[model samples]
Target: MSTVKDVTFDLLRRLGLTTIVGNPGSTEEPFLKDFPKDFDYVMALQEASVVSLADGLSQGLRKPVIVNLHTGAGTGNAMCAILTAYLNKTPLIITAGQQTRDMLLIEPMLTNIDATSLPRPWVKWAYEPARAQDIPAAFMRAYATAVQQPAGPVYLSLPLDDWDQPMDATDVLRTVSTRVGPDPARVTEFGARINAAMAPVLVYGADMARGGADVWADGIALAERLGVPVWASPFCERPPFPETHPQFAGPLPPAIAPLSALLKGHDLIVVIGAPVFRYYPYVPGSYLPEGAELLQVTDDPDAASKAAIGDSLVSDAGLFLKALLPQVNARVAFAGGPLRKPPQTPTGELPLTPAAVYATLNALLPDDFVLTQESPSNIPQLQDQIRVRKPDVSYAFASGALGWTTPAAVGLALAERQSGRNRPVLCVMGDGSFQYSIQGVYTGVQQKAHLIYVVLQNEEYGILKEFAELENTPNVPGLDLPGLDIVSLGKAYGANTSKAETTEELAGAFKGALDHHGTSVIVVPITRALRGLLG
Candidate 1:
């Protein structure tokens, strides 16, 4: 008979989930005791960063990753990143240790109260095994649940003593298939719609990127074949289409009114691998463009069902695109239209505007670098200036949560190293967002992850300030976050830190940092200027 820990470790090795990322505690020690030599453990200072790290690693590896959290407090701290992972459809098997099984009647300290409900609605499944001997089987189920279509995080609570139980000989392993094909009839109908529409617009979503680079390539081919413009989903977390493509239309605004206005001229809108729409700030507008038909192709049935106005089909995004491509014949000749370019906003001196800084970086960024961003106030300017020309080259928190980018960048850098891809990872963050996960720098230093941290210092929560301005509020306290020394913080975490006061300084810092190895942090203090939303 194999022990519970022995069976679980073997299963994890078989599933390629031996790389565990987590922040451990007393309750978790039993599982970690006599840890397998084949398994690698990544430790983060906080639970939130731990989950975010694993989230990015999973995305980069294009596989489900394992995460270990402490009992109650650790799970609570990880909720934010867990939610982000759920929204991003990233597959993760998250395990939390519980108090030992013996102290059931009298609750022990650090014991999770109703542990299954902690990550409710966000996780696809949650459970604590009914018996100590069933722990390994429960984990196998968790893995299958996490990797299924519309994949998301799944939770497992293991009693501290469960690791010592013996497994029966009949306790064997099984395989689970993750992909499901679309209904042929539905695919045929949607393909016919594409073939017949006079002006059909393609709205690409992060799902394509999450699906893998091959799916994104197919989407490009489909767009080119159809001779239609492609617009990225509003606040898309991944780059679905190359921004530099001539037929590429910019992203839609994350507001209903603006999104509706942008899609008005199209006769049909086909949304693929993404929600029909994701809006913010509660702007009153029609669910869709007047007289335009909406059709959504997604792997997520829940997203389809929740769509305000659309006909939806649930299928594997890659398979759907592949099946639909041959059926879509090109009749329109509008694919050669010139891509719009943003006008250069000149800031001739020190204390540059965000636009000027972004423009400078755009000019200096290497072709092979991956970009991660979390500066909402400067998003409009960044959208205009920094152009992504390839799939999987950019990432953001799909949940619109702060603090994800910093640690995610570290994870990406680590993933690149593991995959033998030498591309540099660049993480751009607003000062406020940077502070939320600053300890990620410590991990970067320990791991020697090759990353460039760009701190956009506007000295406040600029996005919230903009929201206040839009609400006509004259004054709002707690909006300012001045006097946060990003350089000192980075240096304390053992990163090479520097400050940039102008575009020239920023250009130099970026160029030098990319050439150097390990982690580098560059703080660019920019003048506060929120640009209007992009069309």
Candidate 2:
């Protein structure tokens, strides 16, 4: 009989999870003992950084990545990033160590408080196996659940002593359940609606990318046939359509009310692989435009079952697009010119604006580079200023969480290196958010990853300041951070660093940093007034 470790390794191999991202601890020693030579473990300093790094790797590699964490405390530390993964719909198999099986009733040291329920509402599934022999099968279940429709994180709590226990070799890995496509008639009905509508708008969501490039092709073909515009979902992690394509309308407004206004003239709104729309607080609006119809195609049963306002089709986005392609007309030309450009800020001798930084970066950066942005104040400005020219090159925090970009940049760089791609990874983070996960730079240095971290030192919590003003309380406490040096932090973490006090300095530093072989940080000195203006 093989030990549990053997079975676990076999299951991981079968699932193609050869690379493990983790922050190991004493409880995980048994599992780490005799670690296989072929398997690679990418370690981080903290559990949160481990999860964020895995999030980026999963998006960049387009595959589920495994992450390991120590029990209880470790899992607790990683919760925020886990929530981020849930919102982003990134596939991850996160495993945490539990106390020895016999110590459950006694509550051993480091034992989690309700280990099984720790990641509730965040993970698609969470389980702690009853028997040591069941660990491998539990892993299989975790993987299957994570990669299934509406992919998200799954959790498994494995006790330390269980790894050395006896387990059957024949029961390690099992077949995953097959996914069924949508009804042919339903797809046809949707296609006909698009064909009949005068001005149909195609709202592409992260699902298009989840469905793969083939699905994107079908979506593009259908959109072109209807002569409609394709708008990417706000806070989207994946490219919904080819950004350089003439029919692309760019990202939809982050605010639902404004988005509704923008879509007011369109007759039909066809949302595929995304929610009708994700909204923030105080964003009051109906789901659809006045007198406009909503149609949705998705593989997630919950998404299909819960879509109250739209005609929901329970099917794979890829299958729906493929079947709907032939039902629509082959060619319809768009009457409008390319999307109207937003006005640029005047280039006066004032402190460099977020718009200027975006414009300059957009002009200088390579088209194939990956960008991870956390400068919330500059989101709207960046959207209008820097346009993504290629698929798989742009990313933002879909979870609306801060402290995500820094670690995510490391993961993106790792993915590029693993895939044999040479394009640089860029991260733009605010000073307040940068402090949250600045430790990630050490991981980048350890991996020798090529990434340029751009710190937009705006010296305050810009979003909170905006919220305070909106709530009629202008003076708020704990919103400002003065006299902090992010460049020194970067240097302490083993990264090449630079400071940009002027536009010329910023441009030169950005170019030189991108050319560097190892990780680098370019800190831009910005003003407090620059807050709440970017997004």
Candidate 3:
């Protein structure tokens, strides 16, 4: 009889989970004892980075990736990242060690207390095997649940000593449907409505990109067929449509009243692959513009249910776009000039404006390069200034958390290697957000992951300050961070580092990072301006 570890590894290999991301501990040693030479283990310095790195890899690979953590303590460290993964809709199989079964009642060191509940609400499914032999079976369930429609993280707890347990292994390989197709009648009805409407606007989100290249093309084709203006969803975490497209009308504001006002002229508002609305700051107003009807297509039941007002079709974004394409007519409304003008490149000024940085990057960045951005205070400029010209080229935080993207840059670099695309990855982050997962740099160095970190150092939490102003709160303490040698820190993590105080220097630093094979950090001290939200 094969032992649990033997069978589990075989299963994992078959499932394409050969690369495991983890931050290990004593409780996890048994499972990792004599790790297979054929398998690769990506070790992060902290559990938070471990889970987050895996999240990026999963998204890049478009599959479920397994992550190992050190029992309860490790899970606690990774909870915030798990939440990020949940919001990102990335498929991850998260496994953690539980103290030996004999110590469960005694609650000894590293013994998980309520293990299943730890990652809950965030995870689609969470479970600890009922017995040692059940561990392999549990993983299968976890993988299936993780990749189902509206993919997200799943949790499993394995006892340390259970790896050696006797188990009779049999072929457990099976294939499951990963996408939910739109209901035929509902889709036909949606098509009819689109044809009947005199004016319709298409709003899209990350799912269009997540659905893969074919799906992204379908989105552009569908938009062409309908001849409708396209608006990006509020706080969209990925680029579904090329920002440079002529029909693109830019992003919609997140608040309720303004969001409706922007769509007011359209008789039909068709939102697909995103939530009906993702709003913030609690601006109360009509859910939809007067005389405008809304229809949403999404893979998530939760988003469909929580939608304030909309007729929803639960379906894969790509499938719905494909199905509705032939039913619609090619119209002349789309054959027009650009809906928005490109921001003019800024002139070099002292202590460069955020627009200058974005404009410089916009000019320098390669068409195929991938960008992960987290500079919240500079979003308005980043949006109007920077442009994504390719499909699946942008990613950002949906969980409103810091530190995810910096480490995610590393994972994306690894993903590039795995996929043989080897695209250069640039991570744009604020100074305050850099500290949250700085340890990820060390991991990147060890892995020789090639990426760049462009830090916009304003010496303060500009986003938080903006929020305070919006909320009428003042004199907030501990907002300023004046001292830190980021150059030294980057060097300590074995990265090439540079600082730029002028636009010319900034361009040089960015170019150096692009040419370098490994990690680099370019810190630029920008003008400190707290641009208010919706500015």
Candidate 4:
């Protein structure tokens, strides 16, 4: 007979989870007893920061990451970050220590009102094993569920008392099977329809990256052969195509009305990996253009099933791309006009422009660096000024959640270090969002990870100002942030800091920070009035 701790460690090792991220609590002491020397534990101050770090590691490493948490309270604390992981479709196996198996019936202290339902709709699977012997198998199941198509987070509630109980550990580890290609007839029909269309647009999603660059290149080849322009899905977490490619049409419009209007002239809209479109609130428009037809190819069954206006085929993105490659005839030449350029920044001295900052940063950053963007007001500017090379190098919170960038950057830095990669991790976060998880800076400092945090100090919730103006509301509450020193905050977290009021100063600071060995923060003073231009 083996103790639960031994069994859990074995399961984790077999599952390739040598790294664990968590904020340990009193209830988790039993599980933490006799911690294995082979595994590395990444400790964060808050549970939300723990999960967020794990999320970024998963995306950067392209592997399932394990996260531990305290009981109900810890799970609740991590819920927002968990939602962000779900939206980003990151593969994570999250485990939380329950109060105790024996005390569960008595509703003891720190016991959740409903443990399984707490992470609702965010996790692919949530469970509490009935027997102590079942813990190992349950862990394996969580890993499998997390890595399955439409990869996302899974939860397990581990009772503390059960860790000391005897349990058998005889189950062998098994490899998860990859998804097969779509039906041959369906592929043929899709190819034929695409060839028949006058103007077909290819919208690539993040899933394309899951299949790797070879698959992505194959898809791009097919699209090019068909004379189609490739556009990234709205709010895309991955780069559907190399932004440097001539065929790339850049990111889709955030508003549905404008997006629908843009697609009006196209005869066929073929979306791959991503959904038809993701819209924000108050975005009014029909699902599709009046005469245009829609088609979807995705590895995610949910995305395929829920498509409002398209024929969907469920299959591995790479396999589908390979199978469809030979069926389409090559066009004489790819046909597409110049890509749409985002609004430009005006030269100024009084108020700083977000566009200028992004443009300068783009010029300053090396080609190999990774960027984690959380500045909602600078979306258009960054997307326009900085062209991404691939999906793996860029990440943004799809759930519209603030405070995700700080911790996520820590995770990416950790993953990069673990993989022996030398590229710098650049995190662009707004002043408002950075305050949410600034504690993560300490984690980066502790790990001695190479990270540069660029705080876009706009001194207010710029998005709210846009909302207020949109609604014609004159006065808004809680929109202004004044007299805050972000440089001091970074210093408090043990990070090297710099403040830049102009583009030239910012460029100098960014260049210096990128070469720093440890974590560094650069504060760029921006103006609230420049926010609207990014839209």
Q: What lDDT score goes with residue 320 in model 1?
A: 95
Task: Please give the lDDT score for candidate 2.
Answer: 0.82
lDDT against the true structure, each candidate = 0.87, 0.82, 0.89, 0.84
Sorted by lDDT, highest first, which candidate order results? 3, 1, 4, 2
**Alpha-carbon shift of residue 376 in model 4 (angstroms):** 0.3
Candidates arranged by TM-score, highest first: 3, 1, 4, 2
User: What are the RMSDs of all candidates, in order?
Assistant: 1.5, 2.1, 1.1, 1.9
What is the TM-score (0 to 1) of candidate 4? 0.96
Best TM-score goes to which candidate? 3
- What is the Cα-based lDDT of residue 531 in candidate 4? 49
Give the per-residue lDDT of model 1 (tens digit) for 108-215.
Answer: 899987999999888999999999878888888998899999889999998999888887633457888898799999999999987778788999998888777789
Error of 2 at 410 (Å): 1.0
TM-score against truth, every candidate: 0.97, 0.94, 0.98, 0.96
Candidate 1 vs candidate 4: the lDDT winner is: 1
Give the winner by lDDT: 1 or 3.
3
lDDT at position 321, candidate 3: 87
Q: After superposition, which runs of candidate 2 have C-alpha atoms over 4 Å from their true positions?
A: 177-180, 342-348, 530-535
Q: Residues 1-535, candidate 3, lDDT per residue (tens digit)? A: 8999988999999998999999989989999999999999999999999999998888877888889999999999999999999999999999999999887998997788999999988999999999888888888888899999899999999999999999998667677899999998998999999999989999999899899889889999988888889999999999889889998999888899889989988999999999989898777899898999999999999999999998999999999988899888777757778998969667677688889888888788876888898888888788888777678788887888887987788888899889999888888888999999999988878888779898899899998898889889999998888997888889999989999888788889888888887889999888887779766
Deviation in Å, model 4, residue 151 alpha carbon: 1.0
